[model samples]
Each structure stands twice: as structure tokens, then as C-alpha cells.
Target: MARSSAGPAVAGLTAGALAIVGFLAFQASATAPDHPTQARGDSHSSAPGNGGKKKSPSSTKVPADSGTGRRVVYQLESRRVWLVGADERTIRTYPVAPSSVDPDPGAYAVTSRNMSLVGSDGVQVEHVIVFHQEDGIVFGFSAALDGSLPNPKARKKTGAVRQTRPDGKALWDFALIDTKVVVVR
Candidate 1:
């Protein structure tokens, strides 16, 4: 689903993350919150834990315009990344592109922000997790593992469509805002 450019617009581009919370929840069996298949726009054509070659995003991917404001955080092992978001009791995750490190991953903080990726060992890791919250909410799609209908812009698509990787240069990317707060030890 695509965020309506006609409604109230938010600011800046958010990052695309492979939120684990959501994925685990969706993929979970009857005892868990079955993937709200139609809730948010799933962004892939495969299922989680499948294929094993690519990580699927169980969370939604859209532009954020929630005036609710965002909290900030960072990845544990991979530092130097600004995981911009708010604190929540339940975190919804997606299968984002795994990040590498420079000798060791750098440190990140909500207070400290960095927009550039730190390429290490010939591999550039994730720098900033830009959330396109708008698109996520508007379309009610979580960039799910199979949400590629409404918007043909998602980076995940079929070879028939000849989908190219969207660098997301635009200032809008959806994301999972609310989640269980992890107290890094």
C-alpha cells in the first residue's frame, strides 16, 4: 500500500528495518498473533524462514507522518547506527538487510545521529534506519513478506516486473514504531 500524498505529510525519510518482533509474531503458529496477512502491505513474494537466501520484512514499509514523534535508539553489536524510534512495550520487526561491522560494529544512540554508512572490511553496514512510517500507516501495510500489491515501488518484487532496488531517496519510509523496549545490558 502507498502512503497518500494527499493527506498530512510528515518530514524526512525513515529507514527500512527487519524488525524481529513482527516477523516472529507473524510466523508464529496458532498460539501467537498470526500474521495479520491483510493488515499492512507485505513487501515480498516469499514467506519468512523460507528461501533462506533473503530476509523478508514481516513489518510494514510506508511513509511516516504520525505527529506522535519518534524515539531514538541504536543497534547493539553494530554501532554508529541511529535507530530512530520511540520506546514501546511490544516491538514489531521486519526482515531487514543484516548489517556487517568494521572490525566490530560501531555504537549508536537515539541522541547521537549519523546519516552515513560506515563501510568496514569492504562491507558497508547499516548507518541510519530511515522509517517511512507514513506509507506503513496510510496503507496499513507493514512491508510484510508478501506485500507488493498497492505500490509497485517496493524494492522487493518479481523478476517479471523488473523491479530495481529503491534507494529510497525520497523523504518517506514506513516502519514499526511501538515495540517492547530492550534495556541493553
Candidate 2:
């Protein structure tokens, strides 16, 4: 009888712990500039003085194309994209069109979005794609599409598909959009 009573209590405690850790992790990320932009913050920038909040850079580094100097391209996550140069430290951030997903929203890369739109030909307003990761760290784009989440089709590019994490449980998953890693320069 005691064992049965303890099961739910233990589960509840675990859930509570996970939630706390997730939230703290999320807070650290939301306050910082780098953590994959999985969550949104009201602050302009944690970078003191500038007060300018830049978009998060993609985990995948797109190499420069020839003497292009610096070519700005799109990321699969619309909300956050890139400004890649010979120097990785020189990346920049900008806004993206809000995702068509409901309950929560996301971003996409401009390059892939344009292509998908052209191919879409007004067929539909959204696209579907999948991202794979383990231990909450995203590896890269995946060939699979996950439509089971609250959003039927997610177009956010960066950190689109998030797994349960220690901090705030915040995750970004790319659902509705098709993406590829290519040098658009």
C-alpha cells in the first residue's frame, strides 16, 4: 500500500524538479546572446550599453563563398538567420517572419524559405520539416518532419525542435518547413 502511494508522489517530485531546472536554464539562455534563441526575452540585449538585442547565430556555420567579403543569407529558422564572414565572431542577427504555428511561434532561414515559397507556388502557406537531437543539444537538420506537436507545421529555423531540457524545458523545433545546408554565397 505504501509503495503505491509513493509512486505518484515520486513522479510529482521529479516533474517539479524538472520544471525548476528547465526554467532556470531557460532564464540563463533568455538573458544571454548564445543558447540557440530557443526562448524569447523582453530585454534588448544582455550586452551592456548596446541595448541592441541581436538574433542568435545558427549552430551550423556556413562557410564563406570565395571573395564575397560577407554574404548574409537565411537560416531555416526564420526568426534568426546569419551574417557569415571569414571571421566567425563577426556574425549578426535580425528578425524573421513569425511562424504560422499556433500556441507558440518560430523563425526560418531566408534562403530555404524563399525556395520553399517558390516551390509552394501558393499551394499552401506553411511547410513541414523535422530536426533531430539528443540530450537537448541539436545536432543539425534532420530529414524527418514532426507534426505531432501543438503546431501542425513549424517553420522556425533555429532550435525549432527542442527536447525536454534541464532549464525551463524550452525547445525550438522546425516542423512545417523543408530545410537544407548549402553555401548560398
Candidate 3:
């Protein structure tokens, strides 16, 4: 009688495969940035100024009319976006390249997200957070993979508010589906 060698060979191969997977997983985790899951105010005013009145773009404050509690605030005219915390504090704010088409100043919610996709403007975009749509136009936030903004001269009516990669990731973490998005003038 001869003993089959298949059992030991399969076991050895499986172990080796699992070892490789574990090593790759470790490397990915080790290199990933330690970004906080929750947006935190950078010692900025926790409350909206002027008795909850809207602040000017020159002022480094979140718009007062952006509603209460945690939300993503998008100011169309200023080309800025603010990540607000639960206490109505401005956690983070940064400039964005507005798309040719604009959404009306109002409230919206994060309706869908795509980690990576070819945007309507034909750019490779990531961390897409779509919030609003009207008259067949869709509004969303994304960061281009090549860090390029849509051409200002192009006549395309894309609604992708372009952001830097880091900002996109931060927004991705903070604004899950159903997250409130307040757009102000």
C-alpha cells in the first residue's frame, strides 16, 4: 500500500497562500494614513457667529444657515466646503473647483457614493459623494485621480466639485449615505 502525497501538498500550498495574503494585508495597514473617522474642529469657533447668521466668505467660519448638528456645508459662491461636527463646529474647510453647473442653494443629503469612476467630464475621479440633481443634472463631489481640475474653458456642464485627494478622503469618511449637505450662497 502506498500513502498519497496530495494531502500534505495541498495543506502546504494553502498555508503559503495564506501567509502571502497576511503579509500584504499588514503592509497595506502599515502604510495607510491614520485619519480620524470623525471631523474635529481645529480650535475654531464652535458656534456660528452673529447669532447664527450667515458669515462672509472672508470670514473663516462655517455658514450659520447650514442647519444644526453635523453636516457637510457647500458654499457655491465661495468655492469652499466645510465639514461640520456634531456640535455645529467647523471641523475642516477648503476651496474646491466648482463645476460649470451649480446646484441651487439648499439642503441635500448624500444619496450615493462611488469609490472610483470615470466622471461625466471624462476624468478619473474617486471618493464621489453625490447629493443633488435637477433637470437631469447631477451634483456631486469628487477628486480627480491625476489631481487635475476640469478645464475652465470647456463648455461641459459637469457638476463635480473637484477637491484635493486628501480632502476627498476626509469627506468620504465623514459624509456617509444620508449625511446632510447644506448649500449656501
Candidate 4:
């Protein structure tokens, strides 16, 4: 009787340990930085002559009318954002998955920023740059710590523009309070 009871106790402890380990692994992967290609899941191979070095998406040309000066340009039509330097050059540009409700094409400023938060969509996000709000809906840019961009609920109004983890860090560093944000159609 004693041996049988001990067997069940040991099994319970082992299962509990396994559960804890799995949870920790999930946390680690969720916070890891994402490679650019992983954002779009593009598997295109590099040029045969390039020695197998993959080209980064950052090398792509900036969109037209991204605006001049050190500013954050949110291109609604392209669903992209560009961080332009004061010298009128693009410091970085990346694709973002915007919400269904977009701020009107105009100039705005970074009103607030948060280092980390649980977004309205229930995702863990970092580097949140809030620029605009309308009709009780707050609009901003953020990236999920897990590098995932789940589709927003159709019935909910969300203005969070999701980027990759790296891009989110860059945006957080570049966009300060009162930083100009140009929204172009």
C-alpha cells in the first residue's frame, strides 16, 4: 500500500515540474527578437553570386512622400512606417499591421510612450508610441514581444500598429515625447 501511494506522488511531482519547464520555455521564445524575414515568413533565396548571404529587408527603398526631417512617417496606404533622420534620409523603415481604424492623414506628435504593456488585443507589447486617439480609441505603434501579429477583432476598434521586436525597440529609442509623426495617404 505504501509503495503504490509513493508511485502516484512521484508521478504528480514529475508532471508539475514538466509543466513549469514548458511555461518558462514559452516565455523565453515569446520575448526573443525576431529576424526581418520572419516577419513576412519569406523564404526567398539569395543571389547565387552573393555567397549565400541573405539581403535584409531594410535595404529596400523608402516609400515616396515619407516626409522630410527627423520624424515618424506612417504611410496608411502602404501600411509602413519610416523613421527619417534630420538629414532627410531614412534611418529605418518597416512594415506594420495597422488596425482597421486609421488616423486621418495629417501631422501629429508622440503624446505618450510605454515600455511594456498588455495591449487591448491581449498581446504582450513593448515600445509603445501613442500618437493619436479618436472616439475613445487610442492609436499607436507597438511590437509584440513574441514577434506575432495576430489579426485584430473585427468588432473592436484598435489603432495599434504592430511591428517586429527589433523595429519596436528602434521606434521606442527614436520617438520621444513630442516627436513629430506624419501620416500620409
Query: What are the per-model numbers of colliding residue pairs?
Result: 55, 33, 0, 0
Q: Model 3, residue 140: what's the lDDT?
A: 95
lDDT against true structure, model 2: 0.31
lDDT of each: 0.24, 0.31, 0.76, 0.73
Candidate 3 residue spans exceeding 4 A from truth? 1-58
- Model 1: ten consecutive residues of lowest lDDT: 161-170
Tell me which of candidates 1 and 2 scores higher on lDDT. Answer: 2
What's model 4's overall lDDT?
0.73
Q: Write the per-residue lDDT of candidate 1 for residues 132-152, one digit (tens) a residue.
A: 222222111112222111222
Q: For candidate 1, what is the lDDT?
A: 0.24
Tens-digit lDDT track for model 4 on 14-75?
Answer: 87677456434533443211233434433233545679776534334455665667899888
In order of lDDT, best first, we have 3, 4, 2, 1
What does each candidate score in C-alpha RMSD?
A: 18.2, 13.2, 13.8, 8.7
lDDT of 3 by residue, 1-185 (tens): 99786998999888767745643453344211112322443523223345843332335477777788889999987777888889876677767777788899899999999999999888789999999988777899998876667554568777889887878998999899999999999
Between candidates 2 and 3, the one scoring higher on TM-score is: 3
Give RMSD (Å) of candidate 3 vs. truth.
Answer: 13.8
- What TM-score would every model get versus the actual structure? 0.22, 0.28, 0.69, 0.67
167: Cα error in model 3, Å: 0.2
Clashing pairs in 3: none
TM-score of 1: 0.22
Name the regions of candidate 2 deviating beyond 4 angstroms: 1-4, 34-46, 50-128, 131-176, 181-185
Give candidate 1's error at residue 83 in angstroms: 9.1
